[model samples]
Target: MARSINQVAVFGLGKVGELVAILLADAGFKVVGLDAVPRTMLTADGVELETRPLDVTDAAAFRDSLRGVDAVVCCLPFHLNVMIAEAAYDAGVHYFDLTEDVPTTNRVMELSAAQPAAGRTRPTFAPQCGLAPGLIGIVGASLAKQFDEIRSIELKVGALPQNPTGLLGYAVNWSAEGVVNEYLNDCEVLRSGRRQMVPAMTEKERVLIGGIELEAALTSGGLGTMCETYEGRVARLDYKTLRYPGHFRQMHFLFEEMRLRDRRDEVGRMLVDAKPPVNDDIVYLHAAVEGIKAGEPFRENFVRAYLPLEIGGRLWRAISWTTAASAVAVVELVADGRLPGAGFVKQEDIALADLLDTHAGRLFGHTTITQSERA
Candidate 1:
């Protein structure tokens, strides 16, 4: 029998976590929000989510909490994901998270391969279900399917302030730690039809979307497991983070000139301090694939800009809602028996059409496509 998910526990309860809980509840699932500190009731979009205090690090307590829930979504930091996933595994529940940490995801994949519950297949383990790795990967794969042969697949995502300031011209809208990791860590890519690791923040390129000039460069974890999945299939497959012009230069100076590469935590704090998050933010997504379709040379591009909008009676930043909704959409798919019930779930394997069919996934439906060129 396939696994059925009706109840879910969302761990973290931050800006994104609370929204995830609300979206799940709005989707007709019983939802609970867990956090390290105590939290009162949270309601949104005509749905109320039960909230509780729990230290996810407490393995016994976390495992116990997962007993009644059909699935668990971890919105905690990437470092805490493996611990939370272990508890979910022991409790025999489906697991999902928004982590871009490669090592953490590797650990989760190992857990998914372990023994299943008695008379049932193991629960699904899906990670990197955020905007870049989650929605962007789905888009890239969907475009790749239309081609008989693929030469390259390029993806770019940026969550930035609509109005920028300072030399960086960016805001700390997302996790500063994750941002630092993406900059300092080595990025995985498929070069010349072989898997290769390249330095992040290198190979800078100019990108124009809807007449907006931006810069893009290699970013770690944004590609998720696509490199491994599309290694021999595509000659060039890579994901990059887009930023306003001169943002990468400032970052290069911070990490290279100041030599803060080894001190990621401090760098995160410093960056957050310098550029706090702004309420008015926009998310830009650009996905392009080149290959042959029906024996004809072709290139397809998906480019859109997402702005903050009201959800659950409150306005949410573009970064927060997009991330939360993407993850919730995946959970909805798994619950409705559309996605696999067991083993690790790769974002590339998910269908974009199926994703947009869900309630949460509808947020991506409004696209101001600046480029849909086919040649």
Candidate 2:
């Protein structure tokens, strides 16, 4: 039998964390929002959130915070997730996060695959619940299922200002650490039915959405476990980060020529300082799968441009709301027993239709363009 989830504890009260807590509370769950520093109870969009300070580094205090919680949603940095996940495992509560860090996810997988004591119900460890690794993987996998034999799966995502400025043509609407990590870490991909690790920011290619030109290149952690899941079954599978033209060239010069690769924190700070968060931002998603449908070649594309909108009487950025909504929708599914109560949950394992059906998932609507073609 599946365990019921009612009360949820959300760690990290940053931009994304606060909204996740509010959205969960709005979904009828008892929510406890925690952060390293003190936070006032939030009453927004008709939802009253209970928030408090919590130093997660303190082991006893961290465990104590989970005492009456049925589940935990971690919106903290990637490096901090393994610690929170380990604690959640010990506490026997469901765990979820929005980490795109490879090592962090591997640690979560180990915890989920561990053998629980006799009669102990293993908690669910669902990571990569945000937009790129989360929704993009879901969309790619959903499209792949329609084919008898999949030849390739291509995914690209960009969260950028609707209007561009400067050479970078970007804004720091997300975690600077995350963006830097993706740009620096090695990317896992499936090429010619074999899994391989490739350097990030390579494999540059041109991409067009709604007649707007963009460039894409391999990025770390965007594929999540899709390469492993689709290995030997699919001929090609890769994920990339979408950026405006000439963006990658500038990135190469900054990290390569300027030698800022090892100093990730400094680079992140510099990037954020230059390009802070923007209110008028757009989240572009392009997922394409090519394969045999009914013994004939076919291609399906799920492309959309997500924009900021009013939610709960306030406006939220495209990146913020999309990440928050996707994470909250997965939480809602687990709370309603729509997903497994125990064990590891991969983003690709989720059905796109079911995800869209959730209260928060409805925000992913308004597809700018969807295409089906013959290859």
Candidate 3:
């Protein structure tokens, strides 16, 4: 049964979209999904969604697909998000996307200014609502609020296999192109009281979570709004993704020796064609903030774990659930007026504590909010 949907549209039915669409329908919201390939749009109940084979780049068809829709969810690849976001802005529907591409996100934010200046046709615009940047952004920002002068913020997040089977011990849960784009792209970081481009896969560090030791490195795009919000106020800030031991080493080999960094397309195609898929995975988050407290340095740390969940009779790996569920939960929360009414909304705009209180993200854990380390 599709439940009592008010009519929502989801673009893309890959892992994230499938999980989100089913949950939306189950919650009684009519959902229409748009994808270039018709076979990807799964359906249910008389609440059959209105899916149209759309190239998305064709603005005419894209805008037309938004007809009679109140909200739009994008599960498309990051490169494909710009067109859909433009269409959603034109259609005046609340827009949501799962993109970690900073340039793309900045473009959307620029467009957010034009919205509401015209009218409140669209109520909200959220970019980068997936796991790393989205969840970690919220967590890091929340910690920064405690300090009088925010000096430094560091956030680390990752998606990895629960059990290993290969040289990399990794499975491609989402987009291989996205993974390549991030690893090869110019990374952003705040060093020495200034933001600068840092090489990806450097500054490797080890952490213990859920009693399992893991390694973390400077992969791109997890720092959602931290740099923007902190800016000159903070001395140093950065974000990285975490993975199991030896994962970074293997990635370096592929990107360096195999020269995947130079020829991303060939490497992406190779990985897409060759990798073995796995079901079980885990999403890990670690964030810390330091600033002046009573003329002295104070710090706060937070960590959480999210595992797999079964949706639509299929097991949603932790990456799928963590990424999709964060967006789903935020959309539901924003719909209910639990968040801001209009303009660009950052992941950090919503408090971490309140988000965890919600039933959706709580599936992760109670989560330790405040931990101290001497500086």
Q: lDDT of all the models against the reference?
A: 0.89, 0.90, 0.76
- For candidate 2, write residues 125-223 as lDDT tens digits: 899999878999999999999999999999999999999999999999899999999999999999999999999999999998889899999999999
Clashes per candidate, residues 3 or more apart or on different chains? 1, 0, 4
Flag clash pairs in model 3: 4-28, 5-28, 5-29, 5-30
Per-model TM-score versus the true fold: 0.97, 0.96, 0.87
Q: Could you give candidate 3's per-residue lDDT for residues 78-193 as a string of tens digits? A: 88888877777777778888888988998889778884536536557888888867877887888888888987888988777778666776777768888887777767887776
Deviation from native of the Cα of residue 187 in model 2, angstroms: 0.7
Candidates 1 and 3: which is better by lDDT? Answer: 1
Itemize residue pairs with steric clashes in candidate 2.
Answer: none
Residue-level error in angstroms, candidate 1, position 46? 3.5
How big is the positional error of residue 198 in model 2, measured in Å on the Cα after superposition?
A: 0.7
Determine which window of 10 residues in candidate 1 has minimal summed lDDT.
40-49
Q: Give stretches of model 3 more than 4 Å off.
A: 1-6, 39-52, 57-59, 115-123, 292-298, 357-359, 366-375
Segments of candidate 1 deviating more than 4 angstroms: 1-3, 117-121, 368-370
lDDT per residue, candidate 1, 1-375, as tens digits? Answer: 443899999999887898898888888889888898876654565545688889766767877788789899999988999988988887788999999999999999999999976765588999989997889999999999999999999999999999999899999989999999999899999999999999999899999888889999999999889999998999999999999999999999999999988999999999899999999999998999999999988999988888897886789889998899999999999988899987899999999999999989998865555467776
